[model samples]
Target: MKLHHLEALVSVADAGSIRAAARLLQLSQAAVTKALRELESEQQLALLVRTAGGVSFTDVGYRLLQHARLVVGQIERASEELAKLRGDQAGKLAIAVTPLVMVTFLPETVSLFRKQMPAIQLEIFEGLTAVALPRLREGALDFGILALAAALTDQEFDIEPLFAYESRAMARRGHPSAGKHSLHDLLDQNWAVNFTPASYESLMQDLFWQHGAKIAPARLHSTHSYSLMLELVRYSDMLTVAPEPLLLTESMRNWAQPLRLDEQFGTRRVSVISLRNTMRSQAAMCFVDCLRKVIRTRSRSASEANRMLFDRLELLF
Candidate 1:
């Protein structure tokens, strides 16, 4: 009848015994038994049957267990919502961000979120698209920021076009190839690559192939750290491909400069994805708005930087 009683039954069913459930729930064994008895009395059904081995859920108990999980989940969500309404921006916000965004935009986004809603807990996970999409559907992530493509299929997710930007190749600003007029001229140059089996990987590889250049296998293959990749390019003649916004950041630009490839190189759209069916709290909605703002500001900056860079060179492609 009560949430705690339902919790007790659910715990006992999961742990397979009263004593085990008590240990797991940090409640006394008698308390667990008493709660279960009360729940049964209120419901007027034998929820569990005791055997020498342990307690097993009766048919009604099994059905009640399913309902109990939903009830408990909703109750917990309500508690969080109520706390937020009471001037406490306290709830978990687990987001999956691509490696590039985590480096380029996440710092500013998180700083703004903390300033506006300090009590809310923030957790960010960085992986290429392969790792993030599956986790998004499994409820491991509350939302995701990833490149939009046909392969990222999730009917349960509501995908919004966050922004669009071009992906480009970059190297150290004063490197010998910086002034190169064509992608062919930089073929022999070492490149820093972060290749994974995702849309971004295919896009970069295709761009290179279009320019009649292949990624040099002997060059440095990098982990998904944009900062580290930029560092490598800054210290060496190595080139790496990055999203335009990332390469345009003032700090990021000091380390890596965009390489002008063929004119056919195109832009890609990044999307914000979240579960469609779930009811969102005010705090969750605010976080999503903050992310949109970050993307808009970053995208505008990238466009301005692209114009300035094009001024100094032909920007052939």
Candidate 2:
């Protein structure tokens, strides 16, 4: 019936007990009980069934909980929007990013964004698209940069393609399999891969299978942290699959080398995605623009560097 009642209902459901919910809501147990009773009386529904251990939702209660989540989410978003209007130049911008983008242009983009919007607070969540996209939809993130298998529809999100990059096998320079020309050649060595969703793992496996080599699951080392993956490849004979741009980083350039394979490993499409109907704050818009500019500049620089390297190779030949 009231917002507090709804809050109490949701909190109780989450905490699984009246006592725990009271502690979470910072209220007395009696007050919480009174609120719940008032709410039930107003709605004329048995929302919860009490058990010896805790509580469980009734059929109608389960449905109401879903609506309650949306209502609470909307209220929170509204408060944030109002705060942004009041603070014009300052607000929080939350973005989720995949590891590839984090090691590529994100550092430069963040540095430039700080200079342009000194008052804005930036929060970054690092993960794969599967982990980030649900948060994006739930309004926990302003936007996200991730690799997608297919194009997103306008009805769900506004997506801007930042870049498309081919996945390459990389290892520390002078590794035994560095000179290998096919997946079959490296099948005996241990490998590292990003700990993404199952679909991504399948995609990687499919690539190897397409090349007539199937990587054994026991030989694969999966990690969620890029730094750990890099360290593993640098210190050990472990090989990893990564975007080519990631290998060009200053920290990785000297220590790692891309393995030239006889077959293509396929390209991934990375895009910046935001909820279509949501109103973005000024800080969010500024950050997105900065990201676009940085990616464009990096793309141009990479192209130029490649051209220079080709010219030198031609002279040597």
Candidate 3:
């Protein structure tokens, strides 16, 4: 019936026991029990059944717990917004990003955003869109940056296409295949492929197959960590795929080289994805602006080699 009642019920469900919930809520055991009882009385439903180990929610109780979580989360977000409106500049922004973005532009964007909104807390989750979308829909993420599987419709999300970059094959600086320009020359080498959604992976696979080459089962390794993939390429004979800009970093270039593969892997679209119904807070909007500026600057200053590469691949847009 009351906020505290909902809070107590949700906490108990999360903590799995009244005593644990009391500790988590920083309230007395009796207080937590009383709140749960009062909530049940008001709802006219038996919410929880106690046991020696902990507790279990009744079927109805479990259903109410889901609603309770949303209510508590909304209240917390509302409080954060109110604080921001008071000129506190203090709020939380959670962003989900693909690993490519994490390595390429996110750090610079975060740095610039933090300088402008120092009081705002930023949480970044790195994953493919498939992993991030459900969380974004559930209100866990404020926004995301990744390659979309399909064009966005206004019914589900507000999608803004940012930029597309060519995917490049990378190898250790002294790799034997460094001078290999043809896909056939590199087909025999081991590979550490970035794990994207299946749709994107299929696209990549098609690129190779279309070029008369196939990534061998014994030679392929898949991962979501850009750093690990880079390391594998650096320390071993493994090859990996990444955006040209990511491979061109000075630190990365010191250990690895973007191979001049004669095959085109087609540009991947990176976009900003946010829930359609959610209103963007001032802080969230500011961060999005920061991201846009960073991308624009990088796109404008792309190297001549990258420019030519993009041009050749028809990815200049």
What is candidate 2's TM-score against the reference?
Answer: 0.71
Q: Model 1: clashing residue pairs?
A: 262-317, 263-317
Top candidate when judged by TM-score against the true structure: 2
Which digits, one per residue and each the tens of the lDDT, describe model 1 over residues 40-117? 998899999988898999999987886776566556567888887786666877778876567656788888878888
RMSD of each predicted structure: 9.6, 6.4, 5.8
Candidate 3 residue lDDT tens string, 1-317 = 89999899878976879999999999999999999999899889999998887889999998888677656766777788888778676688888887756766778999999999998888888756556776666566778887753333546788877767677787888889889988888768888765445445564555576677876666777665666776788887898776666655554856777888778776667778887766767778888889877766665676884464334222222
lDDT of 2 at 288: 78
* lDDT of model number 1: 0.69
Runs in model 2 lying further than 4 Å from the true structure? 1-74, 87-90, 149-156, 297-317
Count of backbone collisions in candidate 2 = 0
Higher-lDDT candidate of 1 and 3: 3
Model 2, range 1-317, lDDT digits (tens) per residue? 79988888888977889999999999999999888889889999999998898888899887777667556655755676787678756567778888867865689999999999898788898856656776676566778888765433546888777666676888998998877897888888988775455456565654576677877777877776767778898997898887776666666878888889987777666787887876666677788789878765554465865443223211100
Candidate 3 residue-wise lDDT at 248: 50
In candidate 3, stretches whose alpha carbon ends up further than 4 angstroms from where it belongs are: 1-75, 86-88, 98-108, 127-131, 148-155, 179-188, 196-218, 296-317
Predicted candidate 2, C-alpha RMSD: 6.4
CA shift at 117, candidate 2, in angstroms?
3.5
Better of 1 and 2 by TM-score: 2
